[model samples]
Target: MRRPGSVRTLLSCLSATSLSVGLMALGGGAALAAPDTPPAAAKPMPAQVVAPYFETWTGQSPAELAAASGNKYLTLAFLQTAVPGSCTAYWDGETGRPISKDTFGRDIAQMQARGGNAVPSFGGWSADTTGTELADSCTDVDAIAAVFKSLVTTYGITRIDLDIEGDSIDNAAGIDRRNKAIAKVERWAERTGHSVQFSYTLPTSTTGLQANGLAVLRNAVDNGARVDVVNLMTFDYYDGAPHDMAADTATAAAGLHDQLAALYPKKSSTRLWNMIGVIEMPGIDDYGPEETFTTEDAVTVGKWAAAKGINTLSFWALQRDNGGCVGTGGSDSCSGIAQDTWYFSHTFEALTAPHHPHH
Candidate 1:
């Protein structure tokens, strides 16, 4: 399932727009825990984190998989409205998983109890296209901001990831509403002494973010929102050319570095790199053989990510880290390549060292 919410391909999931400057550069550093201190629920998202996307629809406990995968941080995939017209968002758009404490609340608390956390993400290919994306479905800016606030208060989590792809990227009104809500939430966080950060997870071509993704950031800047991390889906280029998945990630990230340099001109090159995040699909993506990310590639990217001092290193999912379905192009449960389970997780988790990020 080469997809977001399962991305079959990124080509159809994207479009372009112009770009801006902003504040809130995400550093790759976190406060060291006191030797005798208890694990805090309000742990700040590390300056550099290895948070792979965790698919929520699979009925697996996120904390359980995270523990199994050796991932201290997992970006929970998609909280969107159950219907196209609703302002309320539910996990996987399921009513049973509404924005309530009963929904994955304990799971998140459990993760935090130890020293881990989940980055709750919004919008995926399904939500972006079906008009279920929050900003696209709900025009009320206050309501959108309320939902974001709820996550902070309910989960005590620090970062929110917006996986904007498909028509959502091309959507001007939705883009503006989303960013405006982001600004609103950031302002509230600042006033309340809450530590919250927002990350944009958008699709990318081989070189970098195309126009549509840039437009979203431009809107965020125009609306006075702070974008902490710009996570790129470095897979699924879909340009009908052979891909060196690892090399493409480097090129794409370098391209994003340049784009980010312009959008955040006031920041230093190091800060701009620190603001970057690269998400690989792990094994074969929706585009088949041409875009396969071999195990060796994962090794390359992981070490490269650490050396570059990037903000985050992640894959399409935690579940898809095994070699259960070899030769397959896309499968939600396996990497489709020969590799040990949790290989990607173990490889990239090194970037989260207490001493790394150099900031």
Candidate 2:
């Protein structure tokens, strides 16, 4: 129940294809820098450590998010367009509206008051260069970078996630444009003396590179762009095919780890920040009668990922699966509120807890 335009703030999309390709290339090239001798085993931390993906439009107050998530790290979605000294376009829910810098500042203050981190994200699905476009034109990288700098300074945010999506990655110019944008952002960070971290959401499959998006990421890294992490969108690959949830999660995690390790050896530790979906896609029916992820299913996947040394996990949404569909009356329906609750609470517990019974 986000106010009409709330969600737009989190509507940015990132191309998954580009990220996979870049990581693959880096992983394949050189042996990562390693100490000659093996390092000692590091003890695992508690399992309650979890990162929650939040939609700007959920209309939920910052206090509500903090309460539901138990003060875990929350990634607030897309901050679409930025006007020089004016307002920025954000989605409260579905409606797009211009919001002032001060208003956004107040929102962040509220989030911080709840013991949460508020990170601004850019780019998202349906980014047809209209509502949430970062730059007026592709070549306006400097301008875009300036806007990002302004956002960080204005809101006192330290991390920024870029979620570029769509067909803008189909040509040489597109790739260059994207790369320049990344570089510009990096330059801004360096000059401003801020620890502005950058991450991108890319396609899960490496084969999806022919789309030109992957090429953009590869070129960016090749040219020395500072990308801290890559979040791989692994779901949504269903094509009317039956999928084994546990097995698919395992395979995808393993494959992504291997590929990313091989491509970007230097940044191998920054492997797939796997995107798990809790909501059912509109047209897909392969994930059983009622789609979505269950608590047991989430735990299974979390265990599998933990065993493989993949630590970062982000759900597609926090508000969408608010433990509401738990006891609606049918086998196909969700198990109960406990399921949704465990899906997150347990997943966090699993992540932060010691790894006694290894996956």
Q: Which TM-score value belongs to model 1? A: 0.89
Where does model 2 exceed 4 Å of error?
1-49, 82-101, 113-115, 128-131, 135-138, 169-175, 206-213, 266-291, 326-342, 352-359
lDDT of 2 by residue, 50-154 (tens): 455565543445436656556445566655543322223343212223333323445555555544455566665544234334543334656556656655555
TM-score of each candidate? 0.89, 0.67
Task: For each of the candidates, give the backbone clash count.
Answer: 14, 49
Give lDDT: candidate 2, residue 302. Answer: 64
Q: Whole-model Cα lDDT per candidate?
A: 0.81, 0.46
lDDT of 2 at 26: 11
The candidate that wins on lDDT is 1
What is candidate 2's CA lDDT for residue 108?
56
Q: Residue 321 in candidate 1 has what lDDT?
A: 90
Number of the predicted model whose TM-score against the real structure is largest: 1
